[model samples]
Each structure stands twice: as structure tokens, then as C-alpha cells.
Target: MNHTLTFNWMMGFVIAAMALGAGQAQAAYVIPMIGGAQLGPMDGTPMKHLDISFDGTNLSVHVDDMVPTPLLRPLESPDEFDPAEPWAVLTDKAYNYQYGWNPAGFITLPSNSAIWVQRLSQDSGLESYQRPPASPPYASIFASDGDIWQWSGSMTHNVYAVLNPTQSVYSASYRVYLGDSVTGVALDGYGSDDVTLLFNATVSAVPEPGTAMMLTLAGAAMLRRRRTA
Candidate 1:
């Protein structure tokens, strides 16, 4: 009888462990890039205004041109970039939430114009898990116009360990559309050379229920073992 009971209990524990591991929730939340403009120009030109958005996988750029000129284009099949690479950074602000921005870098425009960027993220209470890398730096893209833009170039941000609700932080990199409005920059107090890139991102994390259940089961097992001994 004792052996049978012990075997049943061990089996229960094994099942609980498997359930906890499998119950994790991996989710990613995306907020489109809206309202932005370039502040300065790299070639000494005035700033520009642009429109941008993300498809949770890639960036979609829309440029407001006087004619039918395509301002920017996204890289085709850009699912090759590593998420762990630090292409941007988030600043732990004086407030509760951190500031998110893109890393400073060059993206080839379809119009053959290389534009600098400062990608900005919407204010959300998302936590960071690791420090941003130094090589591929992130930058701060301020909000201007109805689209996000950069006057001079890409910006760099430093990542800090964030206490995310899901206890997970994941990032991926890809090339997307970047556009600018010829007239909106100056009106929005930005230069006309900035562009916004859309990205298709996917993030994952463990759910809370599974974690809590596992902890409870562990404690129970420990207590049982102590009583039996």
C-alpha cells in the first residue's frame, strides 16, 4: 500500500512539472510608429516628416511626396536578423515606464538616399531583461508630424534589465519601409530628410498561472518529503 501511494504521488509530481513547463504564454505586443518628423539633416538639409507602422513582422513606410515618388522601401524577406542583437535601446526614465528607441544605423532607401533615424516606441510599462549591446547602437526618435522621423541619422539606446510581467524580453531586427513628407517636417518642427521603418516583430514570455502552480506544487512536495522523513 505504501509503495503504491508513493508511486502515485511521484507520478502526480511528474505530471505537474510537465504541465507547468507547457503552460507558459509567449506573447508579443506591437504599437505602430505614428506621429514623427526629422529634427536635423545629415547633408545640412532641413528636416522632413514621414509616416510609419509595424506589421508585427516588418515595417510599412509611407512617404508623402509632391509627385508619385517612392521615398523608402523595406528589405524583402527580412526574417534573418537575430533578436538578441542590440539594434536599439530603452531608457529607464524618471517616471515608471522606460523610453524605447531604435539604434542609430543606415538603411538603404529605395530612392537611393541613405537616411539616419531615431526610432521611438510608444510609452508602455514593458520591462527589459538584458542590457543593450554596444556594437549596433539604438537611438531616440522623437515624435513629429503624424509619422516618426530622424533628421541626421539612426539613434542608439541602452537596454536595462526590465521586470516584465511575463518575465521575458525578446527582440528581433529587420529592414522595412521608411518615408518622409516633404512639407510636414518644417510644420512639425523637424527636417524633411527623415524616414520611418516598419518592422514585423514577434515576442514571447511565460504565463503567470503556470509559474504559480509549479511553485505551489514544489512547496507541497517539499513539505510531504519532510513529513515522511
Candidate 2:
């Protein structure tokens, strides 16, 4: 891409990224995510990705990853298994659409799956916007169980998706629509312009770091005693 186009491209990406971690707590068992976005196509298919658009007339949003990553807290249990509530996390996997599908115009993955999402750019060309989970800086929010988290342009952020042991599917569906002001009335006829992204993971009970280590040592000792005997 040319310098101007390149600058705009990166700017869009960074703008969207800014909304992600703005006011978000810095702790959640993270599962790293990877993917690339282009203003074009790849492998013949329009990469199903977070498609944010505005053609000088209207604003539209399309939403949709992943790689094996070391579990930050290998023991973070999802709501499906550990009802006691383990590490509430965000994950980046695939858009299985337990709901449905939103075809995209631009984007394609080179190899592995990824968590493609709306580039949270303020230049949405819309007057204003907002979504649920209320505003940012929420405490102890974000979970392995499906929930749509909004990315705001309040500030810049570096958010990472977390994984579950079982590898089930979950989503972060955010609503994107046009409004008169930041916290204004809706005007866009197209509602739910965005979808919280889905992620891949499974379930297993996880323990605190200390407890996990102790359990591991105990198990290893038991195994050794059995072999010695």
C-alpha cells in the first residue's frame, strides 16, 4: 500500500484498538489472537471479518480467529463448568454464529482462524455511538461465557482474548448504531451494526496458582511412590 493508504490503514486499526482496552481492567486470563485485515479480498472469498463502513452517506458495521497460546492462568474455568465464576475472560477464536452470519466485504485470513472485529475508529463518519456493558473501566467484567463487550474510542488499549480449557464457543457482541451524540438518541435505521466476536475454547476446573502447584506436586509424589513400591 502507498504511504497515504498505509497511514490511513494503520490509523484505522489503531483507532479501533484504542476503544478495546479503554478503561478496561488490566487483568483477565489472556489467550493471544492473530489475524490480518485488508481493504480487499484473499483466496477468492471475501474474508469474513469485522467490516466497518460508511460511503459518505451512511455508516454500517460487520463483525466477526486464533492460535494456541499458553494459558495465562491455565486454571481459568468458564461459567459452563465452574459456576463459582473463575477468571472472566475475553477470547479470540471463530464466529460460529450460534446466532447467524454477517457476510463481510473486505478481509481474509492467510492461514489460521482469528477473531476479526470492527475497527473501533472514531471516524465512523457517524454523529455518535454507544453500546451495552455500559461505559469502559468496568471492574471484573469480561467472561469466558458469551457476552458482547463494546470497544469505545475513549482511549487506546491493547486487549487480548483469553481461552478456555474445553474450547467451546463464546462471543463478544457489541451493538453499533448511529446517534446524535456520544450518549445520544439512535438515528440509524440499521440496528445492531456490530457483533461481539466469538472465540474457541473448552471447559475444565482451574485452581488458584498456589493450589494448582501443590496439587501437581502431590500427584507427582503419589506417582513416584507407586513406581518405587
Local error of candidate 2 at residue 34 (angstroms): 4.4
Consecutive 10-residue window with the lowest summed lDDT within model 2: 122-131
- How does each model score on lDDT? 0.32, 0.34
Task: Please give the distance, in angstroms, between residue 10's alpha carbon in candidate 2 and its true position after superposition.
Answer: 54
> Model 2, range 1-229, lDDT digits (tens) per residue?
3655644554555446456758555544332122211111232213234445444344466443322221212222221222232212222211111122332344232222222223333211111112222343212333323222333322212222333334444334444544443333444443335544444434546778854565555556556867999
Clashes of 1: 44
Tell me each candidate's TM-score: 0.25, 0.31
Q: Candidate 2's C-alpha lDDT?
A: 0.34
Error of 1 at 71 (Å): 24
